[model samples]
Target: MRIEKHPILTFERGKEIYFIFDGKRIKAFEGETIAAALHADGIIKYNTSPKLHRPRGLFCAVGHCSSCLMTVNGVPNTRICVTRAKEGMIVHSQNPRGDLND
Candidate 1:
């Protein structure tokens, strides 16, 4: 769910770009952030905590926090909140031990 009728910001998206999230195909915008795209697709849990395995989602919406960490194209610990979405980008949630979630 998003603010479709923002008084100041336009709701129109950029050029369409396809990507993989958890082995599923998802369409996002060219210049959108990974977290934004995931959020748009109703993916709120980006990672799980180490010991407790608690679900984590976008908190700061910036690169300053680890709440949005995930795996991008085989790389671990990627901050999706600040990383710009790209075409064919593979994104997956990162487990607490720094591995991609199955």
Candidate 2:
């Protein structure tokens, strides 16, 4: 979900990248945030709201809100929007209290 063409702006795509999402291999571009990469791969939902387990997604692309929090390599509360996606990294949706692996 990135602008393919812009009148005033341009994007120079980096090298092809790969990461692990929910135990599946997802292809993406280097230098893109985890959320952006995931969104490009059709992953919109990040985590469920605490307590209610209500689904949440990209409310704020910036890391100022809790909507995009997820587990990255076993660490909880990671703001994927600002976290660059690295090759071979493990990413999983976070639950109410912690990572799915926790």
TM-score of each: 0.85, 0.88
lDDT of 1 by residue, 4-73 (tens): 7887888777899989998988878888898888888898877788788998799998699878878898
The candidate maximizing TM-score is 2
lDDT top scorer: 2
lDDT of 2: 0.85
* Candidate 2 lDDT, 28-59, residue by residue in tens: 78999988888988989777888998989998
Runs of candidate 2 exceeding 4 Å displacement: 99-102
Q: For model 2, what is the error of residue 91's alpha carbon versus the real structure, in angstroms, after optimal superposition?
A: 0.3
The superposed Cα distance between candidate 2 and the true structure at residue 31, in angstroms, equals: 0.8
Model 1 weakest 10-residue run by lDDT: 93-102
What are the lDDT figures for the candidates, one per model? 0.83, 0.85
